[model samples]
Target chain A: MKFKAFLTDNGISLLEKRFLPALDKMGKICHLYLTRDHAFFLHNLLNGDGIQSIAQFRKEALFDDYRISSQNEDRIAFAVDLSLLHRALRSVVTIYAEFGADGGAAAVPPSNRLQIKLVKKLPPHSQQAMPFLTFETKGYKSAVIQDVPISKPLSRTDVLELQAALDSAQDLPQTLVQVPDMNQLQTFVDRMKHVGDPISMSISKCGDLHLQISTTLITLGAEFRKLLVIGEKAQVPAEDRNLTAQSRSERAILRGDAMSVQVSVKHFSKSLQCHLAKPDCAFYGIAPQGACLTVIFQFFIPGTHQTDKSISLHCRLPVLDPGSG
Target chain B: MSSEVDAESADLECELDNVQGMVDALSSVRWKRHQDAVIELSEHGIVLVVEESSCVQAKVYLQKELFVRYEYSAQARVRFGVSLGLFVDSLNTFSRPAHSSTIEIRYPGPDMQLLLRSVDSLDACIYAEIRTRIPETISWDYNFEPAGSTPLSFTVKSAALKEAIDDLEWPGSSIQVSLQPAPPVVTFRGEGHGDLQIDFMYYANTDLLTAFHCDREESHRYKYKFLRATTSNIPSSVIKENRGSKLTIGRGGMLKVQHLVSVAKQSNSHSHADSAGYLQPSRIAYIEFFVKPEVDDDNAND
Candidate 1:
């Protein structure tokens, strides 16, 4: 396997300030998947019990002059500690900040650019060759290089399994509804954690979501209605469609049955950490079999409706048995 | 915020519009986990008192005047016991990121629970009902009296006061708080591995000491643990909005620390009933703590 890329100034910032830091909060180690089109950080996607996070970035969006080649169609996947990668990018960003006035063109000088590559190194205390994701930043009078050790490249079969997991994770529910404001959700979850271990999240067909946490003493809940549903309206069963035929507001209030799934409050709390990403809006959906609660964070162009497709984050919170709590 | 609503609300409901302020007030007194607190409702307002041992006690006074809507329907005072930590956490949920929260809090909920409901979410609502039990007998009710005719009081910045107590870190010992009349200064001395003395200059450092008054020089010793507990969790939001906290030497060397919590959002602070005040003092809620001093031979002079 081979991979090399020069990270653009904007790319360095996006990683240093947003994605890497976000991943750092989610977990200690993450899978770095480099392909022809994008670089993805996959967390807890395999051997999971914790939160599963996927942060994807288009190649040109983060790096220029990108190249990757492998025996298996130019794709490489390996696990690396997030803190190490975060430090590497942060150091370069700080150095560039000091010499910010040195650039005049559409980008920084070639010598000042940050480059990352996959390399094998022999440590001073060990004889075995170890794979490293190397970061090199060369300035006019200074050059800084860091080699962060990473797990061995995935085998062909491992790659295929990861591909299948990615496909399954990307599958969205037929109906997607925007969640309550993160601040409210944050406080709601805070209250719920004290009431019970697992919470029941119910989303009705008429765009109403209710989260209830119960204990022997009391049952606490927050109910959100008239939320905006995103994209295509999923096909509804004939009986449900007929039920939604009343006036919109009345129908929303009248609907009582909803698709509900029980999820661990610990996992729910971890997913709330996505607020650090500063998503413009977030949507909540339930995976098939009530297996996972999926949260998609949508980032939009600051002043317009244009979705900034360069970056994306998806979190899957595993569901817990209803009887567990 | 309208007179019509207030006139109507006073007859039978106890609702409030500032959930953030209530949370901030409650969080300041939540020094320990699972602390039982007494909530008393009267014609004047709500009083929440949390006591640690018989030596340390904290109280939050949510005057009816501070509430957006205050209604006292019960013919007699009502009291209930709740977990301070849980109450604060539950109040937090009603707050929204972009807007201040409005909530209606009522006692004697259908099942004798404390009911809290959010009123600000356009098409959404959040509510929490916490189980309330009968108030247990407390050992003491400390009614603070003046140490001297002038009350021997001084006001200092809340954040600075908290920092000073935190710096005196001599564990399992006593913190001696002394006032000097000659120079108008206050000193906190902690004795352990090495002696640490933190002095506040009332005459020179007028900025830190907003006000200073002492009839005579006096000194007192208090448990280091109890002294620190009083200022342990002054909320960050409180530090930003208010000016300072007041420290008074009460009867028998009892220390009283008072902090003003701005319950009214600054931009729209025009009370339904207009009034003039310092830093909108009338609109602010009050938090007070009475700490009984450790009797190290009455004259705790170094």
Candidate 2:
């Protein structure tokens, strides 16, 4: 006989105080997904943060074979953010769980034991079926599981054609690889595998291995890291929510004549400096706090005689403000 | 002998050369009309003659001073009278002639010394001596301060001008001016040894018939002022009449002609001025001449 466990008000209160805080401190919380099996499994490991964890939980729930076999139908629900699925390879794996949208369904017994198996496989770069895994495994129920199937035409064919042309060109462009001396390194680890063996490859001048290998490793490692990230569910920290501030100072006019201008500066870093034309008047002035700095000067009008009457002076204040970060 | 020839040529050049009078003199040579002090060149020297309307000549010699003070404490007065000695000296030396030239003149100005001079040679010679003496008291007592961090600047200012003109009491003549083949246009061309020369005739007006002789028979004076003439669209023919005409041929009506051989033979219209019943003005253009009897040497010296 199947039993029912109703969460009492007192139980709920206790859970909020105890479990919720624990989840908050760990930076991750548990998620519930509906399944035809009406059973649940504790799947996908996560650090305290709930962001990266929920992704893993959704994948596990979607590909659970026991649930698929028990119900012999499609009953999978989509995760909140599908971008988390950017890290899958060959076929997606999942763990099944049970959930009831109605009270009557809750009366059923929990589904089979928790298991992991490939629920669906995807073609190479088959973007049309993205976020939806479609397959024809005999033991399974439906071949597809997703909130919505993709409706746009996939660009994989065009990409393949372009790639072919690129590959056959005689003077194929190549990216040179820069290798660094790795003998001195104590430890190096990469979640993604590329050209070099993970164990003995040397670091290059760019602190990387061969170009293609390094690029692939970086790309794949980013995806793996993303998958790991999605496994967690969390809220933003106080530090992140804090407001950042930036400021700017005023400009002061120093001197002006028929042909040139001198500006006074108080306090600034690289943004504030004199700009003058070449081959005109040479400038020397002061900067920072006190008077005396290098002045940038140029001839106001070229080839005009050096006579005072021939000179003209112009002065303008530049906008001085720190841009928003 | 070529040097002698060149010297002779130089003398001939001196006689024929167009003398440029003082900077501010009779703007145009007019007969029977008297200017204040018309600077003129003579075989003797540069002269500034005083006529009936001689107020400007006296005003120009006062160093542009409105008044003067005897002492720093004294009130500046309207100087009604002031004496200044103006004399000519040799260009080679700053020495004045034994006898100083002086004239009694009145004006509303300050009492100050003014000097003037003239040179014999035109091209290289300066027209007049320009001199000013900074008094020892104020010479080094002041300094200038520039607007910014720049140093001060100093400049010396002076002018060259005529002190007097030849006697201006000569009698008025009936000066008649007209343009031949009047109006629309008159064109001429001329060539000198060096640069090209052009002459044009502008209009003229006069009050010659209104002149009256001064009561003093010995004095060359009149109770009249010279009237100014207005000019517009001046033509060369009028210029030729105004100044006596010179050698310049002008072709007004058109004519055509052709030169060179045509192997197969071709016909063409000849466009020569004479053949076309038209006359071309001589290449050397307009000139203006008017009778101006020489002032008596003794009267001019006076």
Candidate 3:
């Protein structure tokens, strides 16, 4: 298996500064799935709730130039510690900052590509060996190589099951609402984070969103109006598009017909921390009957037309049992 | 002794219009745990000294100019040891920006409790009393004067310093800092999983350093953990003021970092006779951290 990519400084910065930090908060280890067209950082997020968050960096969105050659046609996956990779990227960025971008030393020739190589190395006197991901950049006379060890990839059954879940989730009737900005959403969630457990969120057909938390003593909530509704054309399948169109006309009379989801306040707030990286636009997707909720953040490289780079955090919250609580 | 005790009973009381100015300064040294901080109150100002492990000490001084009313009895000074955490929390209770709070601090005598009362504009008041004990007088003579004719001194933009430090690869337990005069280079070196060296040359990047002076080449290795006590404060300091902070290194390997606290303008103005004539641009608080270099026997000769 071989994978090499010429990643731009901006692309690397987004992953190091924005993408990885959010993943670090969710889980320790993640499977980095590298295909011909994309690099996926898949985290199970076993935050005790068994939620999964996938950060998909399309090849066009990540690398200025790249290539991936593997024996099999399927994507090659490997597990790596998110924190370790973050540190490695930080080190690489630091080197670039200190020594001019061309690599500070005069002996090494300048190269545009920050090469990443995965190699299996057997150290001296070691009985077992594992693969290590090495980040190397050569400039003028200076060169830096940061090697981070990787763990065995997740089981094929687990990967397939996760993919199936994502695929099945797309067909669920979702109420998509455009979040005005991350700051406002973060503030609303932050205030409710400490109020109580199992925050209840409802998005009306008229584009009004309400977040509320109630305890035995107090019930606190906030209402946000005029939230933009994401049309069904983009997300709904072609056959179901007509059905949604028909329902839209009928739902106009029933303004309060809203989709609602109840999720743990602690887990909900932890997911909001990812917004600190500052995504350009965010969308909230709630599954019907309060099954699950998804937050999709869109990020783009500055001065670039590539807008496909995005991260979606999927939270699996149990439908609040009426008698259990 | 009886007259002295009577005089102490009538000691001075301190009052300020805003508690945020005091809380912001104390939060910088909140890293120390279970350590008693001595608060010295006088007519001139209030001084808070926090000592940790007998090796590192931090002092935050709020001058009388920053306070609205400063009064003192006939006594010279009143010093007491209080829990820094509790004191800081009491001040922080009224730290909201929207509400204006007036803080009154009073000490009756040696064994009397320290009373801190905060009253907000909404007629809400919070009263907190902390038991005060006689502060242990430890004579710590820190000579600000340099041992050599010209000590290593430089003023760099806080943003640049913070960025440079954040960018350094902290690979080892200690970081080696080198300041040289000939080439005017400031380099930091660390070793752990790998050897990492970062250098800043005056000629290369002139914008980062405003002033650089060194008589001879001086390099010292300090415990990275100790130096980290001030790392988190750098970003906040730079955000407050564009003007950089000053760093001074003495021959004894002691490092002094001075940060000017940014004071928010008072929205509610009281035209008192005392502060009416004082037309200072703004109140400024200074936080100084003094870190003693760890002795590395291997590098002692070098």
Index of the highest-TM-score prediction? 1
lDDT of 3 by residue, B230-265 (tens): 545543533444646677887577888776664443
Model 2, which residues run further than 4 Å from truth? Answer: A1-325, B1-302
Q: How much of the real interface does each model capture, measured as fnat?
A: 0.58, 0.00, 0.00
Report the C-alpha lDDT of model 2 over A152-241, residue by residue, as the tens digit: 221344334323422221121111121111111101121112112221111111111211112211111100000111111233233322
Model 2, residue A182: what's the lDDT?
A: 18
The clash tally of candidate 1 reads 0
Q: How many residue pairs clash in each candidate?
A: 0, 68, 6
Ranking by TM-score: 1, 3, 2
Per-residue lDDT of B128 in model 3? 47
Between 2 and 3, whose DockQ is larger? 3
Tell me how candidate 2 scores on lDDT: 0.20
> How much is the lDDT of residue B263 in candidate 3?
46
Q: Give the better candidate number (1 or 3) by lDDT.
A: 1
Task: Say which docking band candidate 3 falls in.
Answer: incorrect
At residue B213, candidate 3 shows an lDDT of 85
Write one digit per residue (lDDT tens) for candidate 3, span A14-76. Answer: 788788887787668887887788787776632235455667776766676677776555556
Alpha carbon lDDT of residue A173, candidate 2? 10
